[model samples]
Target: MTASTPSELIARSRRLGADPRNTNYAGGNTSAKGTGIDPVTGEPVELLWVKGSGGDLGTLTEAGLAVLRLDRVRALVDVYPGVQREDEMVAAFDYCLHGKGGAAPSIDTAMHALVDAAHVDHMHPDSGIAIATAADGEELTSRIFAGKVVWVPWRRPGFQLGLDIAEIKRQNPQAIGCILGGHGITAWGETSEEAEANSLWIIHTAEAYIGEHGRSDPFGGVRAGYEALPQAERRAKAAALAPTIRGLASTDKPMVGHFTDSDDVLEFLAGEKAADLAALGTSCPDHFLRTKVKPMLLDLPAGASVDASIARLTELHEQYRADYRAYYDAHADASSPAMRGADPLIVLIPGVGMFSYGANKQTARVAGEFYVNAIHVMRGAEALSTYTPISDAEKLRIEYWALEDAKLQRMPKPKSHQGRIALVTGAASGIGKAIATRLAAEGACVVVADLDLEKAQSAAAELGNADVAIGVAANVADADAVQAALDATLLAFGGIDLVVNNAGLSLSKPLLETTEQDWDLQHDVMAKGSFFVAKAAARALIAQGMGGDIVYISSKNSVFAGPNNIAYSATKADQAHQVRLLAVELGEHGVRVNGINPDGVVRGSGIFASGWGANRAATYGVKEEDLGQFYANRTILKREVVPENVADAVYVLTGPELSRTTGLHVPVDSGVAAAFLR
Candidate 1:
């Protein structure tokens, strides 16, 4: 067994963090002590490299490693100001930095540095915490661990806890690690391989012990009427409640939400002790950081009607907020940070499942995952003995610690459109795609809705992962298809905020040459389609009680009265008027409707690529390939209006700069005096 490099430590961490059963997401730390040449003195210097704060071990990298001089870090032991002043050590780590300091050191830095080992791993695995949280955790650890792992009673993580564990290791020479009472676990060794193996041994041993001796039904068996409903009913109920729940959770600030109906959640929610354990809340620091001190549990059983559940949810929500504020008031001191938020991140319903919210989709999803891990911890602990967690007062201490306050202060500022959900029709290509891309770039979760499901999916993948964008199939001409797309939006990222009605096609023909089928097709997809999208979106916006935006991608032809374009022109005109009508009607509800008028978006356009380019070219007596330049030449500025230009107008209308300016048409055709909204 010998010391290793930072990469070795990261590799070991990734292996251990790969499974949630081993550690919760972003909830563990790993470290290694090594020697490197000092650049200035040309002498060897011992260095401590550990996983930095707020980073997931599974995705660790060189930049995510915090580097400090081992001697400087260990020297703090002499100046130790006791447990109350231990938090100051985190700020002191910056002074011990070997060079650029790398990433910010976590509160666990002392735990890794003070311990007498070349390699160490600290994790929040459910199985380990299950033993750790049991009422008789010390006795349980002695028996289940075969006298190898010691029990370090719960102490909020900081410098003092690290010193205590290091002393425990020195006293027990044969110990590999210790179960952190009411916390998690820590394992250490002389080498990377030894350290990782010891961690797995502890985690697996606890799991096996719980399996062999624990009760078969620790959660007190399933309660009648709390069992999960049929799949379809469950899904429908979730969709119906998601928007209202999202709005309530966003009382502090708007949040994106994630819903889970996994077997773990449903099973836990149906158990007789589900309400009791959930109310008791999570034990681990990482778990509570995301899940909060407690979840908002619905009083109704699984058999309750959707309407009754929603109605009761509103009442429970108010009580939850009041209780949270009381907790803050009881524990807050003059030095404590102002209450971060009163809204619960996790919400539980007996029949449906769990919903978690955060500033973004991935965050919201991760919060739910942390809560699931807590459930496992509770189940295992209850099987062994009475499940007990650290006191709420200690929780308040950690939650309001100044170090955490500084960490929050250091987070990157929110994007202009962060937490917004946008649904853009015809978003698979051209102007619609450009709009979706810009909205996502500005930090909105986008739904790429298009008739071509495959292309829509491809475009969404290019934008980003599920957190930023998702593709939904929809034919705007069909009302049911449009509703389905909106439904998908709700299920994915909660309620909708911005709706871009951009699905349209153009057919160039003289009044005499235009056929009845041509008129219907244009009207159906553009005029009626815009109406349906706005109507459905408005309903959701009103239900959420959150103001929103609806931007119609009308055409410059709507006002230009251009020749050989009667059907296409009429539909655009109809869309433009609908925007004005809706804007005036929905003003009271804070829903602003606007229109973007652009002329001749030829390149990369789905409509143009599908033969509208050649048709308009022939109608205007220009070559098919020259159509774009020809249209550009007709504009006063003589600049081609591409899809991106139209997208820019959409942002302006919906962004904060023009928030109060609704029902206004912005022309993106370089300069079309005839098409200007007079």
Candidate 2:
């Protein structure tokens, strides 16, 4: 195999791609013509092909390739870190080592370049991160990978990532690939195709192990259970309870589903079992920063009214929030930049399903996938005994890792709204009220608006010290009323700096029994009302050169439409998109918009009696009184949500504390938003 006949190794690469066993997207790359001359072949031909970006390993070709000189690429890695320019990084490689055009080398190219192998492949297998971030990550990895791989903890990608990989290869010259804990994989072979094929083989083998050993579900086949139910029933239930899930889900979707029969789901949903299910969340900590830790559990008794269910979910959410605060206070380094918002990481509504939210699809995907895997693991752990979360130290390390903390700070902050006015809707009680009160305390004049005008007035009176506070009465769903309310705010406060569309109502009925009128009513208040308020505020804030802030009170219910509250969840989901759109549109005007989702704010005003806790209590045969303690006890910190806690979040986002923050949702549900079980 001389440099004159490179076709032999290239033909072998093609044959390797044609193999039938390589069905996994878990791909690999290899390059080997004859680096130092095979002892038997006795020629000096070198091959250096990298797997292309964005293609499945199952069907890669020379086109999905970036070829470079093997020895030269390796030499460049040794000194490339000091290079500053893009041209420098690209030019560090030997020009004669080129393979094909239009295919950028793998992002992992630098790592492979430094390794002693002729071929390399990398993949982000589902099971790898799942196993790596969990409490028993090492045990799981060792058991599954056995003697086949090495592991590295989560680290930023790019040059540093590549350098770390190179170091691993240096130590384990014969290792196939290193399992980057909380990240992905890096594998290699003698040939490009063999490296790719080996990667697929290794991951699928592990996938098979997880599939056979993990918990199985009873509600396995159907995507949306009971989606085919009668329209009348669905409408009736929707109308009866749409208010609860407003802005968190899409109530317009005709058929919403719930998870009722899965033994695995039901057991977790079971009211009596908090310890068994309390620790559940996405498999990784980043999911918490994205989706929140815990969810609001909704379990109402058989005969509860829609209002009752709403009240219970609210209560449970509040409890979760309190638990989250305790966790934060316990684990938070006082010197650390304070976390903003009231959104819980994940929301779990027993008997319904789970919901996970994040700033981007990747984050949401991480949350959703983590929940799915966590559910499987939690169920299995229950079968074995009790399940425990990763140690606090491990969780805290990931949660406050320098990189993640830096990301938290990198978000674009709003300017106009800084040190100005704020209006909190539905400020009479629960999370809405908390936000309103907190903003006022944070030096922003606040207008507390709610249907319960008197309660709003009382809340305003209570918050009037640090900043001007006014009570306003208006139907958020009514354009005229909302307009009047806005006018009143402008009249009293001068101009709006921050708008918190936190007003909400709660109702809980099965989709089959939801009513059209009820659905419209809920949407009008939570979704449409929120829009008008924000639009009104946006106009005023954008008028000034400084940016402003708008926050909506969305719920965990948005992530997963829980049982009996599809309408509410749908509306909340819509709110999330609203923030995304607002961020895009308002970015130019310097208006910072975001959300603060509080799980349950039941204790303060007790106005929302029907929420997650009360409902779940009924379902599990526990008394409503027991729900709060039950939820609080089970969460990571065993804390409960308080008006003060959510209020503190309002203070954080509405002030200089989070100047660079925009389009972010802060989950104040303690670690519930961050917990594994959701």
Candidate 3:
């Protein structure tokens, strides 16, 4: 019945890892033991495939599962008899690796190797941990699970803990699983399926028992009216507070704030017991490593003025950090390295939802997600009975664990734009999409904004990393929509560092033939839209007190008027002038405004998709197919200009290359004499 291959074990690991409810990000590890041919020696050996440290179970692959010699890992129990040997045990785990190259196995590899079952799954399920971390956790497990499970007291995970687990399993040979008090749950069986089923059954049984016996709906009548607001309004409120939160959270190094006002967040914030519930600490000890042991509860007055609100939050943030320092001093081990900064990772602002802070948007977003999960776990535990979690002392141990800190220290250095955030409008396709793609590649988290909501979402998804991009629907013509897009960027990424004002449309009609509607539409989107986006972004950058870049996508027509392109050319000309004006006004704030005037990007561009390419070719008495070559030949270089060419110009302006330059026009037109900047 045992798993004959590692594939089933990998599948089982993924199934549990995929759900945050089952395994909070990187909080669980799984292992399967079987005989395999050693790569170094052509002899049969018992190998244990355990989830490696730093790999998420949800996205786990075979490579992520480290192959260790079972016998080698098990022998480490004797290497440090009676003493906690976390450092030596980690080295032993590395030494036990069966292959030449792969990630180091999870720190719990010893425990996995000692277990009698061939397949074992360990995870911090919210439902299970709620019972496991209770003050009377052992009694609860005995009363509910009875002979089906055994309860083990909290032990720091190490070689000693592995030996303890081995002894418990030896004593209770018939037990299907073990509930580690104040830690998590472990399930095992001869086969992967049985182990997985046993894990699910324990979680479902605990959840069902809680549902039957827990207090009825403590948060039932709480008002969540904030969530009912229009998307624009909701985002505006979030954006209004983001800069202040970011400023308040700042330490020696800058910190970014990510806001989440989802229904769950709103409900949790709206609850009468919100403060009391958050004070209970995280449901699982591992969460303390991400979000601190507990979150800061901010008293955000409803009708306070912006300045008053910022001042109040600033005081609260300082107080929170002071309180954190006290907590650390109360429980910190003298031998532990200097405590990390006392800044709160998760901040709960009643009536405003939650904000999680980190050095960049991705880390902030992950902290926010952990807080959201913590809320769910805490609420469930409270409904059943009084909620209890691991003590502050236990959280201190986990937070400063040498093994975890070592893993972080080993991570590769970040890219050039690692912590920066970029927003690209009209990113659904063409030049905007290219710009977004480039920014993401360069390690900046990107917000894809476009009039087409579905296309924007699809484009963001196509960027291929969920943490690197988000999509928001925004019509550049509407000032409200422009603000909403910026707000969305702030909410998703903490703040905006680079704003690409690239959304525009073309009208290829002569001045005599152009209608009022055509002129208005072109001006509204191209000229006014650029102005609105630049102005809003500048305001945010000034508030952030951080220098920023605003790159506008102008047209070559801005400098050289084409014969039947009055509306498009005129609007683009206005956009170019607006950029210069923005540069002059925002320079004092350390914000730079620049433009890229790209010419005849007929292929793989929105202009062609919107029929402007055919119109221009027809006006020039050429076939539609010849438009690209025609434009390429028009330039002195006689080379076709692609969307990437325009995007490169934007990068140059926004990046360090043009730091001192502003109010400048960079032409991507392959040396057109008349269109050259004077």
Candidate 4:
């Protein structure tokens, strides 16, 4: 048989009517076989493999086995399965199985496949099965197997199973195999002879339950549960009901059946019993396969009107749908199954718990199990007056949740520079200074970064709250200084947050006159420095989860043509886009980022005193004095845009007020929207 994954095997077993209680304790394991490194030969060798988890030898497949090199196997006698105490088994398996044929050999597999060897036979003895099926399984198993039987309770299977069994065997050399109640038994030894004997011993022990209670079938007319119905009449009725039922179900064949075991089922199905018959269902839950684990307990009154009965049943179903939606949404993370809107997975009438509708056998099976399991748990719990399982809210969140997967994909992870420390390079004046001053004014401890230490210090001094301001001098164009600036920022404030890419150098030259050296120089300070600050801030912000923001004070020259400023314009445009990509990648963790394009700030401290004012003023035949107003009236708004106006723009972009907006460019250019619109 093709070996399968543990999940597949468990699924198949459930199809064979395996009980969850039995399956959960069956064990979890996987196996594989191939050539692997041989410890003794220092080369590869071939071997047959089996893992410890597949004690159910009949259904075990090659996929459930693990291989070790033949030469390596002999050398591992002392370290293989059956040689160590239970606690030591896992360690030994890990050591011997380390990278062996790409899997760890099952502990028992070692002795069965090689050592005490033979075609190994291993099983959880019948003593365990009987004990586990009994109410006092734990106490009884302990008492009977004190020293002779290796008794292991519910635990993860595979290496652990082998290790525990080995320990038990070590204590009782004559013991056949461990008895795992609820799970099955495993019997293994050299030569099929020893293995067969062990198997017989376990079977003989369980022969008692078989002798007293076993019939042709363990779940025998247990069908007396459905015997009362007139076969011919009910079959016709069910066939007739199929069309209506199938319309609402996903399945083509609706497996219609009845119940008559309980007093309630019998009384309801007898006489003019549509009212009573509606309540019957399965005896136990298989909800892992079924849906909600239990179905509706519908019992219409004998004298009630048909319309009233239908209305009441509909109401009950609606309640079930609401409650199921709530429960599914609550516990499911990203691992639950998909659901159609408002459709209940299973519907139980008082006598028809397992007769729920579905789209397919798998779905029907799922619904059946869901209802059955629920009945077991609920009835059992109620017997003890307890009500507990996963909560409804949890189930609904799982059932209705849309964000678990999409949110992660759509939002970039928030970085740590997100909200802790603020850095404003070139902050002594202009946009940089505005950003630094603004950040300081609004709760952020600010670092006034500038190439001019004196100016930076003066600016910090002006802020007055020195505790929140730090003046640092360094040409960001210098790599060493940039690193030191980062180190200083981190050292001073413990970490960094907002990084305003404000520091910049302006060099204007026509495209033909823009030399490589001149281009590199401007690019180094503006583009390169901005990239460095962003990289540093990204690291710091991600660590904090505070999600810091990065704002670039790119120029409008980044867009429209400007006289004799080719290098600045191209780089500015590129810088604006770079901010866009960063925002895309960092928005997930709550980081908001944006850029500001300021046209002209003649009144800013960063502007040159004589040459800057004169040169710009010469363009429109206006004196240095009327330069700001001349440009103000040139745009659609016809109003002079001030340094303070630009400052306010930056403040707004970085504040909580604009938390949802990012990767946006707000131009502080006295109504330049017309140019773009045109």
- Among all candidates shown, the one with the greatest TM-score: 1
Query: Which lDDT tens digits does candidate 1 get at residues 501-584?
Result: 999888888999899999999999999999889988887888777889999999899999888989999999999999899999
Best of the two (2, 3) by TM-score: 3
Query: By summed lDDT, which 10 consecutive residues of candidate 3 come out lowest?
Result: 223-232
User: Could you tell me the TM-score of candidate 4?
Assistant: 0.38
Reference-based lDDT, each prediction: 0.91, 0.57, 0.80, 0.52
Answer with 2 or 4, whichever has the higher TM-score. Answer: 2
- As for lDDT, the candidate ahead, 1 or 4, is 1
TM-score leaderboard ranking: 1, 3, 2, 4
Clashes of 4: 83
What is the TM-score of candidate 1? 0.98
Residue ranges of candidate 2 with Cα displaced over 4 Å: 1-124, 129-146, 151-174, 180-185, 190-192, 211-280, 296-305, 329-335, 359-366, 376-390, 405-678
Is candidate 2 or 3 superior in lDDT? 3
TM-score of each: 0.98, 0.41, 0.89, 0.38
Worst 10 residues of 2 by lDDT: 250-259
In lDDT terms, how accurate is model 1?
0.91
Candidate with better TM-score, 1 vs 2: 1
Give a tens-digit lDDT track for model 3, residues 199-255.
888888888877887677754456443223445554566688776676566654566
Per-residue CA lDDT of candidate 4, range 295-352, in tens?
A: 4544543333434544565576567567546555655556444654444444333222
RMSD of 2: 22.3
